[model samples]
Target: MAPELPFDDQEASTNLPLATQIFRFVVTGVGSGILDFGLTAILQYALGMPAGFAKAIGFVCGTTTAYIFNRRWTFRAEPSMARFVAVAVLYCVTFVVNVGVYTYLSHLWPETVLYSLLGYVIAQGLATIINFIVQRTVIFNIK
Candidate 1:
């Protein structure tokens, strides 16, 4: 078997190319968004949770997944408690913005089948932009 590459070696593959970083980030975000959206839909439609609250709950799940994958796959960073807590705090700040946007948009449009997805998308898009930028620059920077 081939010898395992060090964490830094794996990270260098992702770190040099900005395009690669963005692509990986977007892929990770899309995966987590699907999880988040699906969970929110289930909570709101099946369990009768309010749209805003359901979205908040779902965001927690998605954020957790994103942190794990982004740390391991996207950024290739070894685990650290300080990093995890920093991410948690960042997610908390983003959570409010995410849910606030969802709430406002959900109010503007009825939470019908189609509009529910749209509202989620719009809010997720905002959070996605914020997440990608900060995660790459501040939280996960290796250089």
Candidate 2:
């Protein structure tokens, strides 16, 4: 038997379909990634900050954008304090996961642009998969 969704049909129907949700995720992620890379470049080059510090700033900005879009558009969940906390925790985990990948790649590549890019690619891909699973199954309680 199929499990009942927490939301009523009318509310659920208002949400985007799965394909639409994925499209929104990709669009939002690309926008956020651009913001991240821009900030990283400015901080690292213009401000003369270290790569790690610049990456930190970029990650925070990008993750903030992602949280807003994923919660409202990708999952279409109602906002609440508890939901925010749950999502925040998830972001924290993703932060560690992403930075760890970046740091590891940096060690291997030693100041190459590909190091940073590869780290972002792998970390973001993993984070996106985890976020979708956790948000739909647990935090939002979607069917």
Best by lDDT: 1
Model 2 lDDT at residue 88: 83
**lDDT at 63, model 2:** 84
Colliding residue pairs in candidate 1: none
| Candidate 1 per-residue lDDT over residues 1-143, each given as its tens digit | 12232233453332535675666677888889999999999999999999988999999999998888778767666777777777887888889889999889889987786898988888888888888888778777643
For model 1 the TM-score comes to: 0.86
- Candidate 2 colliding pairs: none
* Predictions in order: lDDT: 0.80, 0.71
Whole-model lDDT, candidate 1? 0.80
Which 10 consecutive positions of candidate 1 have the poorest summed lDDT? 1-10
* Regions more than 4 Å wrong, model 2: 1-15
lDDT of 2 at 79: 78
Q: Each candidate's TM vs. the true structure?
A: 0.86, 0.79
lDDT by residue (tens digit), candidate 2, 42-66: 8876888877778788889998987
